[model samples]
Target chain A: MATTMITTLDRSSRAAARGLSDISIRNLFIIPTILFLIVFNIFPLIYSLGYSFTDFRASTSAAANFVGLQNYRDLLSDPYVWSNFAITAKYVIISVAGQLLVGFGVAMLLNRDIPLKGLLTTLLLLPMMLSMAVVGLFWKLLYDPSFGIINYALGLGTFEWLSNPKMALYAVALTDIWMWSPFVMLLSLAGLSAVPKHLYEAAAIDRAGPFYTFFRITLPLVAPILMIAVIFRTMEAFKTFDLAYILTSQPTAELISIRLYKMAFQEWQTGRSCALAYIVLIMVLAITNIYVKYLNKVKER
Target chain B: MRKTMTSLLAGIGLVLACGTSVYAQEKELTIFWAEWDPANYLQELGNEYEKETGVKITVETTPWPDFQTKAFTEFNAHGDAYDMVVGDSQWLGAGSTGGHYVDLTDFFNKHKVGEVMAPATVKYYAEYPGGSSKYWAIPLEGDAVGWSYRKDWFEDPKEKEAFKAKYGYDLDVPKDWKALRDIAEFFHRPDQKKYGIAIYTDNSYDAMAMGFENALFSFGGELGDYKTYKVDGFINSDKAIAALDAYKELYKFTPPGWAKSFFVEDNQAITENLAAMSMNYFAFFPSLINEASNPNAKNTGFFANPPGPNGDQFAALGGQGISIVSYSQKQEEATKFLEWFIKDETQKKWAALGGYTCSAAVLKSPEFQNATPYNKAFYETMFKVKDFWAVPEYAELLQQLNQRIYPYMIGGEGTAKETLDALAADWNATFKKYGRGQ
Candidate 1:
C-alpha cells in the first residue's frame, strides 16, 4: 500500500510539471508585481518628469504649456531655493554626524556583558519606532519655553528652543538625532555582535593600545556596515520634513522638502516643484552612490 | 460544478443588489472646512438638516494650514468629492479664476443675497474684489483681528496707580498704537512670570500676517497699489518701517517664546494669565468667554485695533465664506442646504450655535449683540476691516511678508527698514511673475 501511494504522488508531480513550464510558472508569479510597479510607481515618476518641463499650475484648470527647461532654470537661479538647499545641507550634516556619534557610542558601550541588556536595548530603540509626526509633537512640547520639562530640568532661564532662528535649526537637528540615533545604534549593534572574538584576543596579545585596537581592528570590521548606516541616514536626513515643520516655524529651519512642499502646494507651482524634487533626488543619488562605492571598497579590504 | 457556478452568480447578484440599495438609501453631501470649534456646530446643523430632508450631510475638516492645499488639490483633480467648501476669503480669486467654485452671480441675484448680508461682508468675502458684482460665495462667518485685555488687571487699584505714575495716563483700553505700547510697557512683569501682551510672530502659518498687517495698515502702509499690483513704495514706505518698528518693540514685553507663537500659544498665554493682553481673532472670543477657569472669562475687555500716528485704524480681515464646488455631483442638494443655512431664522440659530454668521439680521439683533462679552467688539471690528490682496498670487505675497518680517521681528535678524526693503523687492519680483508688476 505504501509503494502504491508513493508511485501515485510521483505520477501527479510529473503531470503538474508537464502541465506548466517552469518559465510560465515564474512569469505567472511575477507578472502581478511587475504590473503593480509599472502602474503605481513608474507611471507617476514618468508623468511628473513630463510636468517638470511644462508651465503647469496644479491648482488651475488651464492647459499646461511646454516651457522647455524654464522651470529648472528658474529654480536654479532662485535665491530662495538656494537658501533652502543650504539649510538642508547644514541640517543633514549636523543630524547625521550627531546620529553616528551617539549611535556608535551606545553600541560600543552595549557590546560588553551588561545586566538587563535586552530590556535596555529595547527601551533605547523606542524613539526610532514611534511615528515621526508624534515625535515632532512630543519634542515641541518638550521644547516649550514656559512649560517644558527640559527647561525645568536644565534650569535654564527661559530658553526659546524652537522660537529663536539662531537656535531653531539646531533644536530641530537635536530632535532628529534623538529619534534616529537608535536606528544607527541597532545597525551598529548588529555589526559589533558579528565581529569575531578572536580578533580582539589577537589585539590584546599584541598589547595594542585601546585606541589603536579600535582604529585598526574593530573599525575596519565595522566600516562597511557603518557606511551602510551612514548612507541610509544621510538620505533620510536630507528629506527631513515632519520634525522640522512641526517643531519650528522659522525659515532658518526650512529643509528642502518643506521648501518643495511650499512651492508645490502653497504656491501651486507644480512644474517648478517637480523640477526641484528631481534635483534633490539626483543630488541624494549621487551622494548615496559615493557612499556605496566606499562601502564596497571597505568590504573588499 | 453546476451548483458551484450557480452559487458564484448568486453572490454577484447579491452584491449588486446591496450596492444599489445602499446607494439609493441616502443622498450624501459633503462640506469641507478647516478644523475649529465651529465645526461641531456645523455638524450639529448638518444632523438637523439630515433629520428634516433625509439627506446625509458630512462635514469634513482639515487643519487651517492644510485646508487651502487640500481643497485646491481636491478641486484641481475635478472630483465630485465636496459639495460645499468654507474657504478663506483670499481663496476667492483663485477659486473664481480657476473655475473651482460655482459662479453665484445668478444665485445671488435670484436670492438677493447682497441685500441680506452686511455690505462689507458681501463685498469683501463674496465678491472677488471689494466691489466686483460677480459673487462667488456667501458670507458665512464674519471675523477680524481684535484686541482683548485683562480688565481685572487694568482696573486693579494698585496696578492702575502704578500705571498712572509710570505712563502719566490712566490705565484704559488703548485708542492708539502709542497708548498700546505704553500699556504694554507698564504691565510688563517678566520677573513675576507675567507678560504684557501675547502677539503672534511665527513664520509657519498666517499668524504673522494676522498679527502685523493691522499695525502696518494703521500706519498708512499699503500692501500694494491694489489696482496695479505695484508694491515697491507702499510696502517699504517710511510709515511702514515705523509701524514695523513699533510692532517689533512689543517683543520685549512678550513671553520668551512668543516669537514662535500662533493662535494656540497666544490664547494659552491669556488663559494661563501669563500675558495681560492678547491680539486674536474675534471668532475665538467665544472660546475665551467659555474658559471658566481663566480670569479672562469674567474680566475680559475687547477693543478694535489701536489707531496709528495718522489716526488711521484698521483690522486685518479674518474670515471665510461658503461656496458650492463646481464639480459636486450633489449640487442641487448642496444648494438647498445653503438656502436653508442663509435663511434669517437659520442665521439666528447659526449665531446662537457658536457660528459667527454674517447675516445682517443676526448682527443687528439685540440677542446677537449681547451674546458674549466680546460680541459688541466683534461687530465694531467687522466694519473697520482691511483685507490683503485676494489674487491668485496672494499666498506667494503673504509668504514674502512672513519670511522677511518674521526674521526681523521674531528672530532679531535685521533692521525693520532693511526687512521691509527686502520684502518690497521680493514682492515686486512675485508681482512681475504674475504679470502684475509695474
Candidate 2:
C-alpha cells in the first residue's frame, strides 16, 4: 500500500528527488581515494616532475644549482645512455616476443588432455613466484665461471657469464625467460580453454585439417586474450630492474631502468633521471595504447 | 565538489604538518660506517659523544663491498641520510668527486689532529692528492698485510737440521718471495696433516687481487703513475711478471680447496695448526690472543712482510677515514664529536676494544702498546706499512686489474707476460683518462 502511494506521486516530485541525488555530496565516495592518491602518489610525482626541469645534483652543493634543460641536453648526447636504452628495448622486445611464442606454444600443448596436468601447471609456475632478486642472484652463482654448477655440468671450460661484457646481458635475459615464460603460458592456456568446442566441431565437419582449423577458428577467438598477455608482459619487461642489476655487471648490458636508477641514485642527477623515467613511462604507455587498440579492432571484427 | 576540496585541503594540511616537524629540528646528522667489527665499538663511543654534547648522532653502516655503493648513492642523490661517513682510504678519490665530504685540513690543523698523526702515516695515508693540504677524512683504522708463523715448527731442532740440509739455511720463516715458497714446499707433509702455506682465494678474483697487489708492491712495481698515463714502466715490468711467477710456484705447495680461501680462512688454517705460515692483515693478531675464537690456534706469532731482492718489504696499508658531510646542518656539533674522537684517552679506549690502530698517539702510548697480548706484534707490524693507490679511478683500475690479470696470474689461466701486458695496456688507457700519464 505504501509503494503504490509513492508510485501515485506526480512526475515533478520524482524529478526533484533524482536531481537531489545527483548533486548529493554523499555520492562522493571516490573523493577519499582521489585525495589519497594525490597525497601519496601524485604529489611526489609532481615534485619529481619539477625536478626534471633543473640540474639538481644531490651530492655537491656547487653542482646542486639549477641549470635548465642542461641535464636533458647532456642525457640526449650521452652515448652510454642511448646504448642502455637500446639494450632495454632489445630486452623488452625480445623477451615479450619470446614469451608470447613460447607461452602460446605451451598453452597449446597444455590445452590438450594430459596426465598430471594440474601438478605440471603448479610446478611450472614455481619460477614466476620466486623473488626476482633471488632469481637473479641464483643465476649469478650458477653462472660463476669457476665454481658454478652450470660450468661443472656443461664442461664448458670457464665461460665468464656475468663478468664478460659479451655474455652478461643475455645471461640476465635467460634468467628472465626462465622465470616469466610460465606466466604467459598460463594466460594463453586460459584463453585457449575458453574457446567454444562447437567452433572446432564445425571445422571438423567441414573437413578442415588441424592447422587450418587453428588459424581460422582458434586464433581469432584467442587473439584478444593473447593481446592482453602481450600488453601485461611488455609493460613488465620495460620496468625490469632487479634481475639485470643484480645478475649482471653494470654499464655492460645496462638497461634503461638500471640507468635511471644509477643516474638518479648513483650519479645523483635526480632531475635528469626523472626525465628519463618519464620518457620510459611515456613509451610504455604509448605501446600499451596501440596494443589495446589493436585488440579492440580484432574484437570489433 | 565540496568533499574533493576538503580532502585536498587535508593533504595540504598533512604536508604542512610534516614540513613544520622538519623545520622544528635545528640540525640533523647521520654517520655512515662499514660493517667491520669496530663499527660497534664506534657506536658505543657515539654514546659518550652524545652525553658530552647535546646533539643526537645516528650511525648507518654497510658491508665493505656495498659501503661505497651506498655512500655514493646517498651522495649522488644529495640525500642527507648521513652527516658523516667512514670511508676506505682507496675510495677518497671517488668520494672526493661526489663532493659531500668537507675539507678538514684547516680544521684538522687548527685542532692539532694533523700534527698528532704519525709522521710515516701522514706522509702516505692521510695526505690528499695534489698537495692541496686539504684532508677529506681523518684516519680511523690502519691495516697492513704481514706474515704469521708457527714458531714451534721452526724451533724443533731436528726440523731445523733438516731445513739446513735441504736449503743451506736455518729453518726459519722465509724473508723473501722465493724463500717463502721454498719453505712452504719443504714443510708440505700431506701424510702428516700439514701444508707448507695457505693463501685464501674464496672470492677468487678479490682474494687474488689482494695477494697480487701485495706481490706487485713488494717487487717495487706500481699499478700506475697517479699524475700521468705512462703506466708501462712498472705494470708489465720484469719485476711484476717475476712476482706473478712466484705466486704460481707458491700455489703448488697449497692444500686442496686452496682456491676457496681468504684472509680469515688462511688465518684460521694457521691458527688451527693446518698450515705452517699465513699472510694476512695485521688486524687478525688480536683474534689469536683469544683461545675462545680459536681453540687449536695457540702461541701465534707475527713478522713483517718478506722483503724482495731490493731488501725493501712492502704491504698494502688498508685503512678507513672519517669525514663530515658538507650538507649536514650540525657541522659544529659533528666536528666537536670528531675533536673528542681524536683525543688520546678516546683513541686508547677504541684501540683497546680490539679496533684497528688508527691514531698514532694511541699506537705510541706505552699503556696501549703493552696492554694486550698481541699489541706489541701489531705495533711492530705498523712500522713496515705502505698504502695502496688512492686515486678516484682506483675502483675502475682495480676492476680492470682484477678481472683481466688476476685470473691469469693466480688461476694459471694465462702466462705471466700475457697477463702483465694486458694489465699494462689497460692501465695506460685508464691513466690517460685520469690525466695521470705522459
Candidate achieving the largest lDDT: 1
lDDT of 2: 0.72
Q: Candidate 1's residue-wise lDDT over B30-115, tens digit each?
A: 89999998877888888988899888888999988888889999999998778899989888988988989998888899999998
> Poorest 10 consecutive residues of model 1 chain A by lDDT?
A2-11
The TM-score obtained for chain B by all candidates, in the order given, is: 0.93, 0.88
CAPRI grade, predicted model 1 = medium
Model 2: per-residue lDDT, tens digit, B1-438? 597799999999999999889757554456888776677767877766667675666677886546667887776666666778887676666567657678788877887766666654554555567466667877777676777778778788999999899999887768787688878998888667688887644332245566766677777766655555466867788888887777767767765445445676677777667778887766666666568876644666666677776776777665677888777767787787788888887787778676775677788788877787556656765666655566765654665665565456335676888888987887776566446646
Which DockQ value does candidate 2 get? 0.13
Q: Which residue runs does candidate 2 get wrong by more than 4 Å? A: A1-126, A138-174, A202-241, A244-301, B1-29, B50-56, B63-66, B76-81, B90-99, B123-125, B145-174, B178-212, B227-309, B364-438
Alpha-carbon runs more than 4 Å astray in model 1:
A1-18, B1-22, B292-296
What is the C-alpha lDDT profile of model 2 across A198-286, one tens digit per residue?
A: 98998889999999998998899889988888889889998998988777543456688876775555435566788887778788889
